[model samples]
Target: MNKSAYIKLVNGSAQTEITLAEVKKLFEHYQHMTSLTGQQLGWDYKAAAFPYTMEEKEQGGIPYLLLNGNQTQLYHYLIVGVSQEEETGLHYIQIVLPEQATHGDLAKANEFCKYLAKRLKGELHLFNGRIIYYNPRK
Candidate 1:
């Protein structure tokens, strides 16, 4: 079966649903940008794929991506960070997926986060999941 998920872009007290395809395309852009940076700084051009986790905060606006990966649960991580909303200041955004995800799945997730970050002109981190990003500043 084709995997499906719901993603929300957190931007300053506002959230919106974004399509998975858009997220994947965004990842492609991020990869290209990272590749350029790697060449300029003599760094590796490969990105790592890591596992992650997502959960709703007891009292929260959006969800949180917490890093919880280990030897036994090698595929556990969080995709949490601040993003801009409506051209305003930064806001928190969180994305979660099921455990034991595939590389393709992680790629899509990374793509989505990278896409949103670029759109908001903000920085992002893997938190717990393994990612070989060549710096988001580029």
Candidate 2:
């Protein structure tokens, strides 16, 4: 089986600073995505507890989330897709799975994304830019 995963940005101190409710929402969102995707695809989805981070440079600082995961291929997709920062904060919360997933698996992933986008009341960004289904070249 091909491994596949999803990713997004959660609560952070970038704009207004992170809050309890925001943090709770982030976790809840992750759980929802994981459960939904797992149920549909028959794969175990894991959540990364560590928040994405970036090292501050001595001069101008560039912030980033240093996410590490078991699936290296999916890791790249997750980092690029869900780690986007808006003017105030992140675009969406991120979740990731294995890269050994199939097309049907990704279809199910999209469903979870749509569900999250609706729940978060925000736009769901996928495939690093395009608004279509995620079809990264393997």
Candidate 3:
């Protein structure tokens, strides 16, 4: 089984989906671009096994291309899973850690999740099921 974390929007029923390019840009902005690759999804990413890839995946009936490869710390690939339709405010994006994830990976993932949530000004659901709000300070 794989471990996972989530960065959900606090503003309920606001957005539709989180885009991968946005996540990649965030990684680049935060100097964490090394966390994910620009390789094509389902092709170069898995075969390379290079820890992470920025490739977007098109899931069944999904309207948006999944974003961000887990340092931006996914061992294989990162997917943006949507559990709802248009108004997927919460549960918008999930960081599904690869099965090969370890304690160090989890730690890094948590930190990454925190950073993302804080930057996005949303809520973070940790792997342990703890919810932390990332509202702007002040």
Candidate 4:
């Protein structure tokens, strides 16, 4: 099974929705943040061509952005899928980790997940099924 994490948009939050372009931009921001540190993730995200495609609703498909890893860099590819719940219409941004992801990669993923959760003010569901609330405390 593929390891994955999720950012669930809570109702009444400042940001309860996200666009594909925004998701791409967030990933770009993440890549930049990683590069700003002393160590880079060794992935050329700009050239990787994260594609966005929408399928017909009748076909039971949803819009999604796929970010592929750089094979030349020996990096394992991860996937991000955006989906909305049918009943509540809440959105979820899912980050799927590849099975071959290294320990460093896993740590980086967690960092990214936390960064996203904080930015979106949403709850983050970790790969291990633990949920983290990033919203401000009342």
Best by TM-score: 4
Better of 1 and 4 by lDDT: 4
Query: Whose lDDT is higher: candidate 1's or candidate 3's?
Result: 3
TM-scores for every candidate against the unseen true structure: 0.34, 0.34, 0.58, 0.69
As a whole number from 0 to 100, the lDDT of residue 79 in candidate 1 is 40
lDDT of 4 by residue, 45-115 (tens): 43433222222122246555544444524445556677888998999888777777655446656776888
Q: List the residue pairs that clash in candidate 4.
A: none
Error of 1 at 95 (Å): 2.9
Please, what are the lDDT tens digits per residue for candidate 1 over residues 1-138?
123222223333123444334444444566577678778778755243222223323226643344444323334443443333566443434455555554555565666666665564434554354433322332
Candidate 1: clashing pairs of residues: 27-111, 48-132, 52-77, 53-77
lDDT (10s digit) by residue, model 2, range 68-101: 3334433332221233456755544443334644
Clashing pairs in 3: 20-67, 70-73, 70-74
Which candidate leads in lDDT?
Answer: 4
Which is better, 2 or 3, measured by lDDT? 3
Alpha carbon lDDT of residue 36, candidate 4? 53
* Model 3 per-residue lDDT tens digits across residues 1-138: 387777776563234356666766665554433323434242443222224444555666553333333443334343445453356434455777666655555655676677777777767788899998776434
